[model samples]
Target: MKFLHIADLHIGKRVNEFNMIEDQKYILEQLISVIESEKPKGIIIAGDVYDKSQPSGEAVELFDDFLTKLVSLAEFVFIISGNHDSPERLSFGSRILKKSGLYIAGVFDGKMNKITLKDEYGPLHVYLLPFVKPAVVRAYYDEEIESYNDAVNVIISNEKISMDERNILVAHQFVTSGGVSPERSDSENISLGGLDNVDASLFRNFDYVALGHIHRPQKIGRDEIRYAGSPLKYSFSEARHHKSVTVLEIKEKGNVKIDLIPLLPLRDLREIKGPINELIKIGKEDYKGSTDYIHATITDEDEIYDALGKLRQVYPNIMILDFDNKRSRSNISFEELSSEKIESKSPLDLFEEFYEAQNNKKLSEEEIKIIERLLEKAGGIEI
Candidate 1:
């Protein structure tokens, strides 16, 4: 039994802060081509099937077409919803879809519903673990599950899984110190301490563990337990990482072999850092593939006028711009800055505190009122 592993598809994703619909279409086409050529027995989409809870019509259509192609092979397809997905929307008609070899695990109903797929040798049991909040999981199980780690353990322990079966577990969440991409920073709500950590031993009994939530594809601890990253470059930070899916060949129940198939991009991700004159003159240099997607940082004393237009000739997908050289250079430590504890008080009390702290200059009535509203929205009293 062989299968293709892909995740964080984010089908309706409008990345780089730009609505690049055409680029998305091109990448999806490339992915379909891979499926056609590989012809795996099953395909596992780890999580984040769609970019939004209410995805646009085009996104739904694109996903439907993609599934239609996959359905032709009638391969076992397993999916789980991420934080971005609306469980109700994603799981709609999921039961019926399962009849066609498709399974969507959205809501955490406290049952480890295994989609058993029979191969030439024996049965393969795959567990679909969708993104779940600790509160929800605790309520469903009727327990005090304070953290994601706690909730997962409770689920695993209570799940009616057989030790005799060859199991596969799929999950989506931050696995303690797993790789973080800039794209994820925007989409994922960072629940660092309590909600972030999950032990790899949770899936010890499984033959293979397919993971999601992390954008850059990488093996967490080893090759067997891995993340088949997003199909396309979702962030400038992921500029250097090669996006790809993992193809697994399981000849027997417990044995597994893995292969990483590199994905082709409509525009490659790239970053360049230098002075204004140097970046402007990058076209003159022998930069071959840098034109695809560019994140240029100008390290100059002054802002370069129309910097993007100048670089667009050589780099078409230049979406982000930064000025490390020209902008304010403060070397203050984040830890120290964030550690300053302020007291919750009235608007006037807040003004007195900030006024004395910044420059020992007191604020006027009008200034105080304006600053009060701003700080109120920014959680000034919540210090």
Candidate 2:
């Protein structure tokens, strides 16, 4: 059976105060096109259906339309809620939806949600395990679940899993191998000090483990255990990530083929560094993607007037503007000033030193004249 594995939809997400509704809509349309071409038997959305617990009305409507299209194209559709979602809100009408081959497992009720599908190889079991914390699992079972690893281990142990049959587990959690953490992005809400990590060894009983909660697509321990990653790059740290949809074709037990189909975003996120004038010239001449989201770093030695305004003329979608000049890279400390030294120095001399230290350059003759006039008016010094 062939199935497409996707996760971290993060619908209704915003990047750098820019609404991503249109980009998300466009990407979902491309995903639907892929589904039509592949004709997969099922679609497994691991987790993170929404960016927030309380999503906007438009986000809900868009997801509703996407789900409707998905069910029509595939034989079955499985969805699980991630940490960002409200389980009760996501599971609404799930019982009724299951009748139409759309199964949602948002809330964990002390038992794993299992769905059996038949193919040429026989029966395949797919388990949906939503994002769970140690506290949530501890309340259901009397096991000593102190950490995420212990919680997941206890839950999987309780399930009557048969290694003889082809079994796939869909989950949303931080899985690690040999204490090595998966690649993370700024958009994810990670626990401090790695408290939420679950060992990948606990999933040895399953043929394929589809994971979520990590924004970068990668495998934890083996090829079958992997994270589908987010369909779009949510942070500048993930600017280089090539987002893709994970396609898995499972035959008999221990036999699975994995393929990654790339996804193209509406507006790619990029970073560029140069002087303001040079950057503007490059944007007009050689840069083809002026509308792409950008984080620009100005490396000019002297301060430029209206830097952001100048860049915006060429790159309207610029998200961040920074300076990497000597002033910005300076390590000057003001704590070295002593009371005696401060009292000995004239106010004008102190002001000049302070300005030079702050700007990494001496004040110009015109600026010095302006400051002297102001000081004279205030009767601080005679000029």
Note the clash tally of each candidate.
Answer: 0, 0
Residues 199-293 of candidate 2 have per-residue lDDT tens digits of 99999999999999999999998999999999998899998999999999999878899999999998889898998888998889855577888
Per-residue lDDT over 1-120 for candidate 1, one digit per residue giving the tens place of the 0 to 100 score: 788999988888776676655677888788788888889988888888888999999888888888887778646788898887888898999999988889999887876568887767
Clashing residue pairs, backbone N/CA/C < 3 A, model 2: none
Find the candidate with the highest TM-score and give its number. 2
Please report how far candidate 1 places residue 120 from its true position, in Å: 3.2
